[model samples]
Target: MKDLYARHRAVLPDWLALYYDEPIELTHGEGRHVWDAAGRRYLDFFGGILTTMTAHALPDVTKAVAEQAGRIIHSSTLYLNRPMVDLAERIAALSGIPDARVFFTTSGTEANDTALLLATAHRRSNQILAMRNSYHGRSFTTVGITGNQSWSPTSLSPLQTLYVHGGVRSRGPYAALDDAEFTAACVADLRDMLGQSRGGVAALIAEPVQGVGGFTSPPDGLYAAFREVLAEHGILWIADEVQTGWGRTGDHFWGWQAHAAAGPPDLLTFAKGIGNGMSIGGVVGRAEIMNSLDANSISTFGGSPVTMAAGLANLSYLLEHDLQGNARRVGGLLIERLRAICAQLPVVREVRGRGLMIGIELVRPGTDEAYPQAAAAVLEAAREGGLLIGKGGGHSTSVLRVAPPLSLTVAEAEEGAAILERALRSV
Candidate 1:
């Protein structure tokens, strides 16, 4: 383990953060459990940052990937790939956008990059609006639009990005307001931001639930209200579903559906779950917007047959098993359990999230000061107790992120919760 860690530090970039004081080397996984190289088994609550949508090593996805690989693996976007076409067709239908067209990518960053491309080119504007305390992706262009200063390295970007309000509902300046008034205040703020833009704003890109900034979300219908204002300005609304997509939110298939009154966003970006550990990401948007690029473009590994097959199978499994319903039912119980436990803990500030995507904000015992130390301690304790979780949030990484696979069982949930309870107490 020491040798591996030394080698990793020597070979990899320093910014690529690894969890734990002693980073783990995971070997294999089955269902909701994974074993490290040392042969220690753990209940995987993070699911590789929630990429493993279904269970680990799900036979259906495994078979699909293996079969596709045996037949063919790399047929770039230049060819007519059946798996890609089939998956695209399915996604287009599922995507609420009318006359939708799907463009495949290999990561959430690339998908969001494509969405920005389409939006900027279609609107003939390079101005963008993003929510404060939100995270998009790690890329030259994506970092610019990212509202989280910790994630974004540089302010120099191709597009002019204006940070707006309404991402975090509980801790921001408008936190004290009620739902309706909060929504109105954010809409007014958005309108004011647009009015200050030098030219027409291309689009407003937002995450239904801010993931890396913690599982923080605004009041329901806030985006719908914002959408109404954006529409009046001929600005597009782009829903960044990288972390919140694939029924993780429990209450809705897509997090954007919570604000369905304004209709679907003009464009939607998805990743992290559809591939079930395979690399798959995409953007679904109206045909008119998608076709705005005058020049030709293609991604060499985008929509590869193996990944597409994995995605198709995974998506099928999710729908067939009614994982959304499971998320709603099981997640409700998990949240209730966590909330009940957290109410008695002074270090815990809040337990916020929907369904499987839950976050526990840590604060100083008797004060509201963000307590990153407690979060770190709890994370280490959880691992020691054979439970693996994740950490996020903008408050110096003071939020514990708990998101397991969609197929997580009731017993597994209870086990995880118990382990987490002990970990929190130990902290």
Candidate 2:
């Protein structure tokens, strides 16, 4: 393996150094555990950054992908494919948007990029309003909407901003405003920005619960208010559900449902768990916005039969088993346990999130020392204790993210939380 890494390093470009590669070579996974090349098993609490809604090597998804591969594989967008249409209809029905249309992509980034483009085209605007600390995707346009400055880098030319503000959180300065006040301020800011741009604001994009932005759930009524403001301004609301969709949040099939918003977004993007770890993503939007794009706005690999089959199977299994309820139950248990743990640790500032998507924000008790290093140590200690977790947020600060597969059992949840507790103690 060392020799293999050396050989690959010799061929790989230096630009790949941006990634933090783990030392282990993973072979396979099942349920909630993954085995490294040396055959050591680790409990997967991170769930591929919330992508594996079902689980790794899900039997149903695997069989579907296999069966689809044996049959037809690729079909041009010029012709309708059965799996693609079926998946689209399923998504539309599940989302309670009968008039919704689906546009497939190979990854979350592409789906978000498509959503942004469709919003701009349909609304005929050049400005966008995004929540600070929100993460849309890595594409140029999506990155512009993303609020994390580190992702843009110093050398990269900054995308011209429409507007951005911090998400609803207690730690930020924006926390002073109550939920309604914050929403109103956000709306007023957007209105001002749009007026400044002469009605050139295309959309207001946000995550139902900011995922990579530290799992920050918005204050109550915020999303609903934002939706109303967007409607007033004729701006599209784009929900970037790349990390929070596919029933991971537990209360509903999509994260936005947690907010109890009255109307659906003008556009919504989903990836990650849509195909149960397969490289499949999609943009679902109102028919008007979806149809605004030209006929050539599709990739050769997008909506391929294999990916469609995997998506269908994943969604089918989720619905048939009612895995969303399981996620809610198991995740509730984990959150309760986490809150109890946080109460005991001075470094832990707060615990926030819903369902399987959880975050533990760490702050120094007395001094200004942020505990990002402590968080990394906790993750390393968790790994040693047979659990795998991940971190997120700006500065890669301490936000211990727990996003296990929806199929996780109560026993697994207990074990993972125990590992986390032990990791916290060690740190």
**Best-performing candidate as measured by lDDT:** 1
Report, for every candidate in turn, its global Cα lDDT versus the true structure. 0.93, 0.80
Residue 224 lDDT (model 1): 94
Model 1 segments more than 4 A misplaced: none
The residue-level lDDT of candidate 2 at 200 comes to 55
Candidate with best TM-score: 1
Cα lDDT of model 2 by residue, 1-427, tens digit:
6776787788987555421245556789998899988889999988777877888898999999989999887885767789999999988877656488998999989998888888877877667788877787777777777776655543242334564553746656567787777767766665666667654578888898887777987675577776776677677888888988878888877877755665777788999988878888889988988999765555788888899999999999998998989989999999999899879888887888888999988777755456787887887788889898878776565788889989999999999988899989886
- Per-residue CA lDDT of model 1 for 91-176, tens digit only, reads 99998899999999999999999999999999999999999998888888899999988898898999898999999998878999
lDDT of 1 at 14: 97
Residue 271 in candidate 1, Cα distance off native in Å:
0.7
- Total colliding residue pairs, candidate 1: 0
